[model samples]
Target: MTQPIAQPAQSTVPASKVLDRVLVLEMVRVTEAAAIGAAKLIGRGDEKAADAAAVEAMRAALNELYMDGTVVIGEGERDEAPMLFIGEKVGLAPGKGPKIDIALDPLEGTTITAKAGPNALAVLAVAEEGGLLNAPDVYMDKIAVGPGYPDGIIDLDRTVTENVTALAQAKGVAPSDIVACVLDRTRHDDIITELRGLGCGIVLISDGDVAGVIATTNEDTGIDIYVGQGGAPEGVLAAAALRCVGGQFKGRLVFRNDDERARAKKWGITDLNKQYDLTELAKGDCIFAATGVTDGSLLAGVKRKKSGVMTTESVVMRASSGTVRWVRGEHRAKV
Candidate 1:
């Protein structure tokens, strides 16, 4: 059973105005709730249950906020999940808060959770009206790198080896010094083989490409580059994160058929050959938050303490200030 959401105070303040600086913390709690929900189902061998719990918890947490939020990018279409669908209205409807565009993955890595793999996260990004891209649930060819690199360091049009050579040249290192991350799919066999033959190191991930993309930002992660095809919605979300933090990201949507192309057109995407740069994918004042559902390089997974308390790790970033925060929360049992 689902519960109805209560209306918040009517202050005539728009969500976008308040969200950049004020509501970022509240947004972290939303991802935390979703992570906790999914963490409970970790290693349960039921990916569907884990995803459902996360979607439900995330929806409930979102509805408690004061803003007028729309799920611009979500699980699926209206016929998909009962909630958090694309174009679904969330939060208090018609509230006095600003209108915000939300892109979220309640459970970014369902397969990772079922297998208790690394790099699973609950991630979301919020921007002002028309700030985030209205991307469909389609595959996106993406390439990303962490901060401090010159702009145009990575380009999708270039071959994998050429891109690696460019990055190596920019970093003043040998091609072998670069470490790349790619999804472990047969689709990437040639890409992986070429990268390996170039004397570059490759880290293969089963799922959770969002985390893999973000890893490029952390020098400690040793992921010099991320190149592969992942979700378009996720591509927008990652671009938002890179926008907040310092990084370079570029993505191009991949369509399988006319139906997929039509779906993109339905979302105002007319440029079938468009390659989105960072600013184009996510722009304006934006906030990004991600909480770990399973232990990964970006954040730690939720843990249940022996004393009846639950702990979780989260990272929240604001593009307005280019500030990033790491949060550790402990949940005490309620009577």
Candidate 2:
């Protein structure tokens, strides 16, 4: 069984005035606890067990927030998954003060957790009501550049080489100075070939596009650009992070199967190729939180012991004030 993290003594923030927003942050902390709980079960080699634990804990945590929140972009649409499904209601039972929009991925990397691979997390982002775009579960082609690259340096429609050359030119550096991250799959062969031909270094991820996209925004990661097809949900979450860090990202939905197209239709999405700027996906003022389930560039995986557990998280930015906080939390197990 899993246990909740020990809550700090009541915050100095007044409950009547600031508690609503503070409750949202606390909700995110609970989700982190849920993810760490599930991660402990990863090494035991049961995928279902891990996902089930995470989903349940995350749902319970969301339910505890004091405001009325709706899942704008969530696990799946109605008839898809139960907890945190799109359109699901969250927060206090009834008559809550403010309404908010929530975007969450209870288990960002189910496979990574199951295989005990690197870079998995419990991720969530919140914004004002109707702030987040309703993203269907589909592939999104994305291109991102770090802060130093002047705006308009990379174009998603441009050829890979063209974009790389443009980035190099914008930075007044040679192509070799750029490091691009892409998914490590055979489908990315052409992208890899083009980058290599341009004298750019490549860092490939086996899974987890969130890490790949976020990597480009951080200086220490050595990733200048992230380009490839990845989960649409992750794209929104990444956009929220990039918003605070002053990076640029553009994404377009890619439908691989009839079912995916059908899903898109339900969302009133007529153009599958329409490009979405980061702001379009994650609208005004978003707070993003993520706790690593396994070790990766941005955060350390949860560590557990008989008496207590320790978890690390990287909170890219808070929509309210655009502050970035990276927190390490330690929880002592109850006797």
Candidate 3:
């Protein structure tokens, strides 16, 4: 189960502390390590094993870094996961470097990896202290669109059809020409139905909402918008990705019962119904990094050669510079 984070007293760290550009590649290395770790378990049909392998690899890699970091969005509570749990401290030596907050999904698609499906990835985001939202592990209602549209083009409060129609008009295409990505879950049937009724194309992914949300920003994916409900932690991670490139994202917490609401309150959220934009979720020059564990639209999967060599594809982006770098690596040894 997910644990609520204890709000810390305002840190003395200056708000202007900029994340070093080199950390971007470091993040790529971290995700690559995790992807390779999980890739070894691909098609094994053991989701738990795959996820545990990823968590172990990612935590090991993070600990080798030179900064003082906290796992804001990690596996779960200290009791739920022995390592990489929320509030777990990482990095080489504490108090020796910049204070960084990390939000990660060691393996974004556990079932996908277990089944050797496409679009599996190892994902994480980093920002200066207090930069990322400490979102509880609960459902989040989300709506997002790619760049070049008006600032307020998509609203969570609006109907799916209306948002899709508005996006179509902005792209100078008919509603039927618009493509929206959504998770294939019973909870989103209403959203799927509305898009179908509007003649909008829908991409229903079985998992990995982070990739689904990020797909909107990549024109090659032909995904104009993404809408539905998913993990709130993934929502913050996806928002970080959009922050680095260009996009608009809005998310509202969805609590099913009193316990869920109590978790939200523990994380310092008072306005349960308040819609959060991209900046609100991630702020202050954050970095987003992802490595494909399996082939998909966003990136190529890790490939192993017969010569005991492995290749990985990753993308690392920084919000401050709006710089996005695609890295292709050939690891002489196992990542």
Candidate 4:
């Protein structure tokens, strides 16, 4: 059985207002709730159950907030998803807050969670109205690098070898000393082969390119660059993260069928082959938050104790302030 959401809030404040810091912490709570919900289904071998639980939990938490939010990027369109679909309103119906555009993946790696694999996350991003790109659900070719590099360090149009070579030179390292993260998919065979032939280190992930992309920002991950094709919505989310922290990301949407092209058009994206940079994908003051569902590089997974206390790890970032906050939360059992 599903519970009905309360009437959502209307936008009364101007859209130009920057997102408040309080809202940033609230966003962490949202991802944390989603992570806890999906954690219960880990290793259950039921991907759908895990995803549905996350979506339900995330939506419920979102509706409790104080803002008027529209889901610009979400699970799917109205018919494709029962909840958290595109354009669905969230937050308290009578509250006074600024209008926000939200992009979220309640469970970024459903299969990974089902198999108890790694790098699964509950992720979300919020921005002022028209701040985040209304990216449609489709595949996108993406390349990214961490901070401390010159502008235009990576490009989707360049060959993998050329991009890696340029990045390595910028870092004053040999091409063989560079490390790259990529999704393990047959479509990326050429990318892997080229990296290997160039003698560069490679880290192949089964799923969750968002984590793979974020790995580029942290040197501790030993990931110097991220290159591959993944979901366009995810690319936008990653761009938001880089926008908050510091990095360079470029993405170009890839359409396989006429339906996908039409979906792009429906989203008001007319430039089918245009490559988007970091700011273009996610501009204006924004906030990005992610909680680990399964232990991975970005953050640790949810942990439950016999005393009924649960622990979660999350990272929340604000673009306006360039503040990256790492939060550790404990949920004590209710008496």
Candidate 4 TM-score, true structure as reference: 0.94
Candidate 3 runs further than 4 Å off:
1-16
Superposition-based RMSD of candidate 3 using all C-alpha atoms, in angstroms: 6.5
Worst 10 residues of 1 by lDDT: 1-10
**lDDT assessment of candidate 4:** 0.89
Higher-ranked by TM-score: 2 or 3? 3
Question: What C-alpha lDDT do the candidate models reach, one value each?
Answer: 0.88, 0.76, 0.88, 0.89
Q: How many clashes show up per model? A: 3, 0, 0, 2
Cα deviation in Å at residue 38, candidate 2? 1.6
Q: Extract clashing residue pairs from model 1.
A: 14-98, 15-97, 15-98
lDDT (tens digit, per residue) of candidate 3 on 20-107: 7668899999999999999999999999999999999999999999999999998986778888988999999688888999999999
- Write candidate 4's Cα lDDT for 1-335 as tens digits: 11111111231223335587789899999999999999999999999999999999999999999888999999999999999999899998524667899999999999999999999999999998899999999999999988889898888878998999999999999999999999999999999999999999999999999888888887777899999999999999999888877888999999999999999999999999999999899888888999999998888999999888999999988777676788999998677
lDDT per residue, candidate 1, 179-208, as tens digits?
A: 999999999999999998999999999998
TM-score of 3: 0.94
Candidate 2's error at 249, in angstroms? 0.4
TM-score for candidate 2: 0.89
Model 2 spans > 4 angstroms off:
1-24, 93-95, 314-316
